[model samples]
Target: MIAVLFRWDIKAGSEQLFKEGWSEIVHLNIEKHGALGSRLFKSKDGEWISYSKWISEDHFYNARKSLDNTEQARIKMAQAIIRAYDPIVMIPVIDHLMATETTHINQLS
Candidate 1:
């Protein structure tokens, strides 16, 4: 599996906009582009990070290309970003995906 790590610096007061747009984008990618899934994290230093898994490097690249149509959520995400770092792509050497449990959006707490 291919794992890609992404980081972004968000503009002040745009956090909620970014989160909503990002969640939408991720959902779309998973539904339409054959992405495995992804998780979003906020670092202590304020960098927004996303770790996404894909079937392969080619699949990952292809999926990103599909996002180029300038979808509204994508535009919203871009507007909220101060800067986005180049993605760090990796091939997993050892992976143990032991859990499949997930909470629904409304169940977030």
Candidate 2:
């Protein structure tokens, strides 16, 4: 799989708008394209981050070449909140990996 990392520093009072737009975009990418899915994160420095996964680089590129009207609209909505936007494409690599048993938040205490 290939991953796309998007970082945005949003303007004040635009959080909800950004989130709504992001959700729409993500849904479209996954359903229409071949995206595995995505996750959103917030940094202490006030950057909003999105990590999206695709089945392959071809899937990602093909989707970018053909965006529908709704997708374009969602992209515009996301652009409206931008102070800065940076996007990066990456491939994952690891030497050692292990799985941990599932644990719930309630079990932490």
Candidate 3:
């Protein structure tokens, strides 16, 4: 699997708009592009971080290229409220989970 990390510095007063627009983009990537999943996080330093998983780098780029042309407009709208954008693609070397903890979590029903 491949993971992508994006760090965004949002402009003042555009937090809500950024959140809504980002959610929509993530939704489209999942539903239309076969992305595994994605998450958004905010740092104490005020940077918004996004983590997205895919089957492979090829899947990631393929999905991106297949997006509708309108996606550019949506991205531009979102970008208008950003101070900076940084992105990185990574290949995970290690991922660990404790089975007992996982079992405990699964038991929460």
Best by TM-score: 1
**Cα lDDT of all candidates, in order?**
0.85, 0.75, 0.73
- Superposed Cα deviation of residue 73, candidate 2 (Å): 4.0
- Report the lDDT of model 3 for residue 38: 77
Candidate 2, position 70, lDDT: 61
lDDT-superior candidate, 1 or 3: 1
TM-score sort, best first: 1, 2, 3
| TM-score of candidate 2 relative to the true fold | 0.76
Q: Scored by Cα lDDT, where does model 2 land?
A: 0.75
Q: In model 2, which regions exceed 4 Å deviation?
A: 95-109
Worst ten in a row by lDDT for model 2: 100-109
Candidate 1: list runs displaced more than 4 Å.
68-70, 100-109
The TM-scores, one per candidate, come to 0.86, 0.76, 0.76
Whose lDDT is higher: candidate 2's or candidate 3's?
2
**Model 2 / residue 15 / CA error / Å:** 0.6
Candidate with the larger TM-score of 1 and 2: 1
